[model samples]
Target chain A: SSFQNIVETSYGKGDKVSPFNVATSYNNFYEFGYGKSDPKDRSSSLKTAPWTISVEGEAERTGVFDLDDIINESVLEERIYRLRCVEAWSMVIPWVGVSLASVLKRFQPTSKAKYVYFETLYDPKQMPGQLGGGLDWPYREGLRIDEAMNPLAFLAVGMYGSILPNQNGAPVRLVLPWKYGFKSIKSIVKIRFVETMPETTWSMLAPSEYGFYANVNPSVDHPRWSQQQERRLPGGVLFPNVIETKMFNGYEEEVASLYAGMDLKRFY
Target chain B: MGQYFPDPGKLLMRLSGIWASVFVVAVMAMTLIGKIESLRFVNRYRRFIGLAAFFYSLLHFIIYLILFAGLSWTWIASDLIEKPYIYVGVLALVIMAILAVTSTKPMMRKLGKRWKPLHRFMYLAAIAILAHLWWQVKDDVSLAVYFSILLTPLLISKIPTLPVYKHFFKKI
Candidate 1:
């Protein structure tokens, strides 16, 4: 299905968008499988219709809302964002979505809502990879309330001006352009406003390697690999197209104030 | 080719690395299982499989150099410092190369008594490869765990003077 009234924005202007095939096929949705191609191959069994997102905790409206009802309330727009994976690969994606703050505001979050937590669908039958003991099931991610309110924080329901493929987080997913790709949880089933920090999937799996913030900082290297450079998608066989990474994935001017006076390395 | 391999460099690198490990494990399994009378013929192909493992390792290394690092010495040097698993993988490759070069009929006959001890270094190469796999894992350890389980029994059989091997084989 195609989206109507997608207002074009100059969000990622002057950036070359990655090929639609590459962006859709090469994904890190572990709910389907671990291999890069596994999601595309195995996600056919996933049932995405009649999807509903349950809003809970610290919000005035705390009930399950149909995904269509949520989409109808907001105006969709085209925002080209560069998605940088923690594995040191990057892709420029043209995503269709609305600002996350717009959706959260309707829920009427209370003053005590310090953090916004998100959870993915957890059915092992629908998502076969859940049977394997790779990560704690129901992939979870969280962001500070202020970060979620950032203009770059997006809740993408479609991509390339059409409905999302199942492997690329169909129905609904979070897209935070400034943070690493994993922080943008996919196929979300639940969203909650909490007072304290929520335990995210990757950070809980390896606390020393993945942190809650997960801001795209080139200075801080992962425990195993250096984050100084990344291979842009469609890299040739002989030339990898490796380029130096940027602070906050080149969104420092927009997001730097969110981390004012806080030590990024310590938070990372 | 574009339709099949969206990223040829990454696909080839992964294929070469995985095939190298698979052949290494195959050679070890054949050596252990060939001890049985019914499977004695499997020993005849052990040398070929070991050489195949070495060639795959060489391919994996070449791809890493030409395709990944783009033949840049600076990038290679940086990788040596930043990624310790690269050195461990190199260690395994170097051991396999030495074993392959020495795997000749004349060399085997000349060093009759010492040949068995030198060839036993395959075990060391296997351990290094295992470390290389485990040390670089980002989140999932399932592949490393699977390889470790596959190698555990073959490693146990290498223990000299173990009565369990003798007792178990007598019944077979």
Candidate 2:
């Protein structure tokens, strides 16, 4: 069945949202486990009730807010957006949330804030992968302050007109349409405003392959695989519909100016 | 897949890749373990490991054909151009097949001294297997990197001795 009450935007007007099953089932939440289906099976251990998010650092107002209050305080609309994974898979999602800019404005970041960092929940008991120490737990990701404020940047509360599933970052998650999926950190617990660039989990794991500013640029192919194409999710495998990846995931007109003078390859 | 295999493609790739690594590790152990006392008995199993690795590799290819390519020869043909990793993977699979077919004792006895040189293709097969895996990884490659690291000492040991580097290469 198709989704209802889609908060249509110029960014995702004609796009067909990927089936909710694919969006939730095919995930790369390493915190749950490594396999694509691991999260779907393992994330049941994640308890989402009574969740709290911390907003701190270089901000005028620094405090802890109840997750329910954050949802009740803001407008929640179903906004469909394209999500391109760095692994060359793509999905269209009807996410319910307000712009990240609006959320940040409530926190009131001071001029010293140059970057915005996000962290995921860390607990080996719930998130078994944390026991491996393969990655620095509390998976981290960040972006330039401006990028976090971009209208395309979203803090999601729900999808498919329902509360988020545990596998899809239940309570809340970040959604940056123009950047790779990893940049949109899942199961977010902390959002911080910092003076310097913050190192992301993937970039820290392999600096030579993954860059900090992981904007979707087809030209800057990952050393391992081509970024030029992606298999659109939700039956993409059966259809074998591999499409050419667009610059900034086809949001170039809206986001191109953000990096106008900077060399993407170097920053990438 | 039984009810437990959550994702077949992922598990197949991982299992198949490990088998390739296992084959090489066993080959190296066949020689390296001989030096360590009390471990000499393990050399007898090296051939079985090689055959098992090739079979696992074949299973990997079959799964990719069905899951990723939909078992279409035409799709496989076009993928050869689209995914560069396919070129390396197909070459490795073909080499693996050749090694497996030639592993029988009858063939080995027929070729005599020439059989050892022919079976040395195992090393090339291992490199190809690693390259196939290494080329496809998106970010995390610690497993593939670990396989390469394990192969490194064996690779260096095989290199011809140089007069200058004999000091370090002597142990290898």
Candidate 3:
């Protein structure tokens, strides 16, 4: 509701914006529940006001900040991004937020800081997935310091011209356009600057299946299925419409240079 | 249904597809558990379970067309043509439909000796379901692979035992 109008569109123009009902209702926030639609159904119970982000580790200005303080500090810009899921589905979302680079700069990371690790809230009472043993709890994600500073990397606080939906990651969340959607951890509460790579939740749960980078690489297939195609969601509900998978989720031109020398297949 | 289901068409599609695979497993369960007297009761309901799966599969389609697709013929045509998994699912449903229609007591009596062979089409539907599951997801097919693991033993149990090794290898 407090979102500013900063005019950032014409990014993901090829695909029509996925309808609102489908975009909100269809999601992969396992913390809410296992099913795709569970987040929308169950997340109304989430307590979101007066949230705090505990910023610690390898930063000169390390301290906790209220969600409002962070919002006030950064200028909100609306960017419509094509969100491609690791499951080979996609949607266009108009996200409102500032770049992670601007926010991280205020924290002033030390020379020792090589990576940025994010942590989601861990209460089982609030997030049902914390009760399950499927993943190590308090869902975590990380990025190389350089990747974190990339202008393409974003910290989304809201979407669709409204305050963030609880199911969509209320208060604040990372929104990495080029990576699989899950890399953008939801309901983030802790941010740690680290010298070494932190094992992300998905990567730790199934190392062979999920990788740390998680850049959308169509060539590197998931063990049981091919990643060469994706279903554009909210079609007829019988079968989602299909499309060819794009490298870096159609942002290869913008962010491919970040991985110029590394092998995606091995890292994947 | 709308209030509770939220997305009835999507939910039914997923559930019906899963039921089809489950019943395919049921259709093969007796073959998998050979000579086990306690489990002999499974045969009595095998036809009904298979028919239920077919009914769900058919309802899955009809509900989707009515509620979600608004009976848009063009979208249905595109999905049937573009999604290879849908083609396989249709084939599997066809097998189930034929078997269900002929499952009546009078029809079984009419076919007589040929009925047993005709019902072997269930195996074809089973394999088709597996293929359909494999093709259904864009990636991360752990569920499909899980179903496949359950199916492997049942299919293997159908192998014909040799005369010399009949007793030792019947359930292999």
Which candidate ranks first by lDDT, i.e. highest?
1
Residues A67-146 of candidate 3 have per-residue lDDT tens digits of: 88876534678888888888666778888888899889989999999999999999888887667666778899999999
Give per-residue CA lDDT, model 1, range A66-175, as digits (tens): 99878763489999999999988888999998899989999999999999999999999999999988899889999999999998899999999998899999889999
Model-by-model DockQ, in order: 0.38, 0.17, 0.12
Q: How close to the true structure is residue A241 of candidate 1, measured as C-alpha lDDT?
A: 65
What tens digits encode model 2's per-residue C-alpha lDDT throughout A159-249?
A: 8888788899877999889999988888889989999999899999889778898999998877544687765665332344457789999
Instruction: For each of the candidates, give the backbone clash count.
Output: 0, 0, 0
**Chain A of candidate 3 compared with the true chain A, TM-score:** 0.95
Kindly provide the TM-score of model 3 when superposed on the true structure, using C-alpha atoms: 0.74
Clashing pairs in 1: none
Residues B83-164 of candidate 3: C-alpha lDDT, one tens digit per residue = 6777788898898899999998999999999898788777778788888888755334677888889887776555454335
TM-scores, in order shown? 0.90, 0.77, 0.74
Please give, for residues B34-88, the per-residue lDDT of candidate 1 as tens digits.
9999999999999999999999999999988776655656557666787878888
Off by over 4 Å in 2: A1-11, A236-239, B1-91, B97-112, B127-172
**Models ranked on lDDT:** 1, 3, 2
lDDT of 2 by residue, B12-99 (tens): 5567767766776776657667667898777688777777777777877876666544445544555676666777888877887887
